[model samples]
Target chain A: MVKVENLTVRAGNFEISDVNFEIPDGKYGVLMGKTGCGKTTILEAICGLKNVVGGKIFVSEINVTALPAGARGIGFVPQDGSLFTTKTVRKHLAFGPRVHGWKREKVAGRVKDLAEDLGIAHLLDRKPHGLSGGERQRVSLGRALAVKPGVLCLDEPLSALDEDTHAEMVDLLKRLTAENDITVLHITHSRREAEQVADLQFRIEDGKVVQM
Target chain B: MIGARSDKPFLAAIGALAAMYLLLIVMMLVADAIYGFGVVPFRSDNPDQVSLVSIFSQKEVINSIKLTLYSCTISALLSIFVAVPTGYLLSRYNFPGKLLVDAILDIPIVLPPLVVGLSLLLLFNHLPTKDANFEDMLNDFKVPFLFPKGIEVTHNVLGVILAQFSVACAFSVRTMRNTFDQISPRTEQVAQTLGCSRARAFFSVVVPESWRGISTAGTLAWTRSMGEFGPILVFAGTIPNKTEVLSSTVYLEITTGSLETAVIVSLMMVTIAIVVLVAVRMWDRRNEGGLYHG
Candidate 1:
């Protein structure tokens, strides 16, 4: 479970004020808003990527507000896939596991399992430049899941895909969340995406998160 | 129709001027190299006179070449070591006095090389003097293997390396800063979320992505060090078999009225510069091909 209480963040001239929300354990929560409505800022703040001016962020009942982003154990997939162009898909999947001190053999085993589950096993040897948009997103998802975080944060993971790929991704995300029992805080601008995936929905209006 | 017709002649004139400028430089270099070849037979007329063959036969000239290679290589590598972190800091962070720090970094590049040499010389001149009491402390001070005589800078190999590095490092820092600026920060943030600390993320993600920029910066630093002259001349002095580099060799030859030897050294420098440039380009192309195919 992930919770933000009275969260206030200031970035440049913009401010997100007094936001309160929670994603209950093993549920898909979608934060929907118009563009530039501070949705991504909220996500970043929860993941410790952005500094919170006032309030606390709790992950699995632990107050991670003062923790560094790397210590938060929150998986984040940014808007773009942002895969390391120099590394192959296999290496990308193994990066997080290696960072968490997993041995080489364990990392290889985890990478194989993720690749098979994501249906990207065939593309393991390919670089990001060679992968299509859908394939890159899948690799990114695998990279995020490689660390086995309690809560996964996705910033518009399907915004770059076509309609067919979009539906396929939504289904895949739902299945993954169910199978892994992972809580999710997904941000999107599309009502259709929220309806298709969210178990609980929240909207950002005038820099506030309002549960709907 | 009239404007289009008028633009054609103007564009053609600009293109012709650029072509002429490029051809002029190539012609001058080729002419100088060929002229050096003609002086190969004149060495037997005077023992002090220099010819293409005699320049290589002279121990002083050969030693100068070796010294130039050693100092340039060391200075270039040192510049790269300093440039990587400095570039990353300047590229990624915003803090108080950032603009001031940036301006100071560029001072070496913008100032004349003679000024750089003069500044270094003045700084060394202010080194602590050994008094009777200090002599006891100095007796126990051990110098490293690279500095045999206890950290002497002026008129020494250390001075040569320092002078070259002062200018070379500035160019390297600029190149690496531009390289880091072009990379997206999202990749680093993602790495952090994946349990990698900031330093680990930089090494695993940022460094590997920037290999081309690192190569380009190193090449520029090496080439700049090879061509450095004014600073070394002013600071290091033209000490034969010690402080003398290829550039100093040319200057010394000219001072001794051996214009042929100066031309020979210049020709050798030009050849080495061309070979280094071509090799760097080929390596970049190979990496680019690997990125596309792999």
Candidate 2:
């Protein structure tokens, strides 16, 4: 479960105040908002990328507000896929587990499994620049799910994909998250994407998250 | 046809101006090489005809070359040390007085090299005079470099390195800041979410990505240090065979009326600089072609 209560975040000149939302355990949640709304900001805050000045954030009922981003145990996929430019697909998938001190064999096994599951086994040796937009997103998704975090936060993961790729990714995300029993908070502008993947839908209205 | 005819003079004028500037630089260098390689009488004491090889084989010239290489290497490494953090801070943070700090960082770059040298000379000479000054305080605290009655800095080898660092690091810091600015923070942020600490993420992700920038900055600093003359002349002094570098070797030879030797040393400096620059460019191109993997 991922929960935010009265969270206030300040980013540059803009501010989001009194924001509150929750995604129940193992449910897929989608956040919708118009351009310039605080959807991405809220996702960043939950993932510990932004400082929450005014409230508590809970992941798996643990108060993670005071923790550094690394300690929060949340997987984040930024809008542009934000894959490490220096790393290949295999390295990207293995980064989380390797950093967390998993054994080499375990990391390799996890990487191989994630690659097969995400249909990116063939592209594992190739770096992100070699991959197409959809392939990049799949690699990014595999990277996020590499460590199997309890909560996953995605910022406009499908915003750059074509219709066919988008639908395929939506199915892939749904199946993957369900199999892992991960709670997801995805930010998107498309209502169709939300309807397709979201079990709990929320919207950021007037700097507050309102359940729909 | 009319438009094309009208554009001829403008295009010719533009090409002429660029070609003229390039020609001047190439002619100057080519003339230096031709004259330097020519057998010119350099030894005033013994009038045995001297060539570039004989002049460069002199102990003083060899010492200057070694000092220049060693001091510039140290200065470039030191610049990297100071620049990486300073660049990251300037790139990523919004701290108080950020603008002021940024302006202050550019001081060495904008300040005249002569002024930088003079200022450093004065700073070192004047600091110990004041009661309870920073230098004295460091002395009191038994700092490693300051112990034993505060080791002499002005007119010393250390002064040469410091002088070179003061100017070269400014360019290094600027390059690094631009590099960090170009790279998105999103990758580091994602790395953090993947369980790497900020420092770990910086070293593992950001630093690896910044290889090209770091190389460019190091090369810029090193070459800048190599060519640094005014500051070293003012601060370190032309202590031949001791504090002398390649730049000061040119000055020393000129002062001693060995214009031929000075020109030869200048040619040597130019050759060294070109070789280093070409090597760095080749490395950057190779990395861009291959190691820039996605």
Candidate 3:
């Protein structure tokens, strides 16, 4: 579960004021907005990647407002996949588990499972630069899920995908979220994408989040 | 047919100009290497003149070469150590007086090398004397190590290292800053969200990504330190076999009218610099190729 209460954030000259929302446990919540409507900002704030000027954030009933991003137990997949270019897909998948102090064997096992689930087992030896757009997105998703966080925040994960690839990814995301029991807060500008995947929907207008 | 005919002379002229510029530089270096020292080919008429073999075997010259190599290596490492954190800070954060700090960091680069050396010499001259009140106070508080006495930076190895570091670090910082600027902060943010601490994220992600920049900075600093003369001359006096680096040795040889020895040392410096530059180019090409394929 992820909850934001009266959260205010300022990024450069843009501001998101008095935002409030929640994704119930194990549900897919989509935040839809036009370009630069602060959807990504809210996701960043919830994951502790952005500083909150005011108000609280709760993750799994724990008030994580003051916590660092690392301690918040939120997996974030930024737009563009942002995979470490120097690392192989295997290393990318294993990075989170390794950082979280999992045993090497456990990390390896988790990486294998995630790779299989994401249908990226064949691309594990490849680097991000070698992967196609969809392949890169799968590697990124695998990396985020490696730590087994309670919440996954994705920022326009399918924006760069073709129509066919986007639909496939949406289905994969829905299935994976349900199977893993992970609450998701996915941001997108496309209303169709939101309707396709969201259990609950929120729209951002003028830096404010309103339930739809 | 008319347009093609007209373009021929223009292209040929520009090509000729480019080739001539490159050839002129190469010819100058070759001419200096072969003739600047007044050495005649296949002739031993001037037996009194210092031979290249004799200069290479000279204890002072050999020692200066070693000192230059050692000091440059140490100073380059030190510059990188200081540059990494400084570069990251300058790139990532906007703190109070950030612009001022950035400007100040560029001071040593723009300041005359002689001025840097002179400033260091002056600074060392103000080191606390053994009987000074500050030293006495530290001794009284059982913290004498905090401000030790009798430490001399001028005319010492420490002085050479300091002088080189002062200028080398500025170049390194600029290189690394450009490096960090090109990398996306989101990569690090994603690392943090994956449970890595800020320091861990920096070490594991940012540092790895900037390896090319670090290498470029290190090479630039090392080469700059190797060529440094004015500051080292002022702050660290060219004491034979002690503070004498390759550049200083060249100056000393020239001052003593041993032009042959000076030219030999200059050739050695040029040779080493060329090798390093070629290696750096190869590394860059390999990295670029990796990016293209990966």
Candidate 4:
């Protein structure tokens, strides 16, 4: 569960005023907007990457406004599929659990299980340099989900894909999040992806959130 | 399409350049042999004593070479530690006097070694140092090894390291800055969202992503340190067994009319340079296909 009360952020002269929202646990909440909205800024502030001018953010009822980005249990995927070049897919998946200090045996089994489910089992040995667009996105999603985060924050996860692949990705995401009860705060201009996957959708125009 | 033939001219130019470089290497290798032949008549060693060629095999030559390696290795490591972070900071953020810091770093590359040595001489001695000048305390007491033995950075291996490090660190910082700049900072932000700290994201994501370019930079730094001469000579001097490096050794031998030993040391230095430069070029070739952190 996550809640933002009177969230206000100013990136130079740009200000997002009175941005308030509440995400119930396991709910797939989507931030739907036309373009140039406060969607990504809200996401960044929630993760503590950017400081809020005025507001309180809570992760599972714990105030996390002042907390560091790493301390907040949110898994994120950006618009671009930014995978590590030097690491294999398996090692990329091992990143979060390693940060949290999971044992070697535990990390291996967990990575293998996730790789199998994501259908990236064969691609695990490969680097990100030559992976196909869909394959890279799958790897990005797997990296985010590998840690089993409390909230999954995706900023236009399929924005960079082709038309056919974008549709395919939306379907795959719906199927993957079906049973995990992962709270998702997705930012997108695409109404199709937002409508297809979200239980509750909000349009963020300028800096305020309005129910659509 | 029509552009296929257009690139042929550029390709031809590159091929010609490669051939010229190869010819240059062959010429350099032969120059030492020619110099050695000219100086063979000089009284090197009688039947009782070892030959001049065997001077390279002597414990003094061997030990100086090893010490040179030691100095270069430690300096390179320290430079990377200090400079990599500086590079990342320069690439990612805009801060006060960034241009001034950049201009200062560029000085060592263009400046003479003697100037670097002289400047370091001032800093180690008493000449308006930043924050804490320890010269006052050192004057009062003759401290032992761990402490200062009465102001002694001139004519030492440590002075040599400072000189080489200033130049080598500039190269490392410039290369690594480009590497980090090429990486999209969005990836690190994403990692941060996934419960990875800022330091964690740097180590786990950015560093690994830019490792190939970073390795190439390190190779360049190592080769630069190996070929280091001027600053070492002025600051560290051509000490018989203590401070003499390969380059300085070659210089000393040539000046003292021991041309055979000079030729041998120069050959060895060239060989090491070729190996490292080739390795760096190989790394550049490997990554050119956009494979490793392009």
Listed per prediction, chain B TM-scores read 0.88, 0.86, 0.85, 0.79
Residue-wise lDDT of candidate 4 within B1-294, one digit each (tens)? 775668778899999999899989888788875765565433455644435556656777897789778887887787778777988999888889999988887888888867876766655555222343566545534333253444456677777787778778888888888888999998898778777778988887888777776776787678888888877877767787778888888888789876677786787777778877887788677765545232
Predictions' DockQ, in order: 0.66, 0.61, 0.60, 0.48
- Candidate 3 chain B, which ten residues in sequence have the lowest lDDT sum? B139-148
- How do all models score by TM-score? 0.92, 0.92, 0.91, 0.83
Per-residue lDDT tens digits for candidate 2, residues A79-101, read: 88988887989899999999989
CAPRI-style quality class for the chain A–B interface of candidate 3: medium
- The regions of model 4 sitting more than 4 angstroms off are A12-14, A34-38, A103-105, B1-52, B58-60, B126-151, B258-260, B279-294
Cα lDDT tens digits, model 1, A150-211, are: 89999999999999999889999999989999999999999989999999999998778899
State the RMSD for candidate 2.
3.6
| Ten residues in sequence with the least summed lDDT for candidate 1 chain A | A124-133
lDDT of 3 by residue, B1-294 (tens): 655667778899999999999999898789777774557233344667567766776798889988888999999999999998999999999999999999999999999999999988877756666666764655555333443576777899988999999999999999999999999999999999988889999999999899899999999999999999999999999999889999999899899987777777888899989998899989987886665233
Better of 2 and 4 by TM-score: 2
Interface RMSD in Å per candidate, to 1 decimal?
1.4, 2.0, 2.0, 3.3
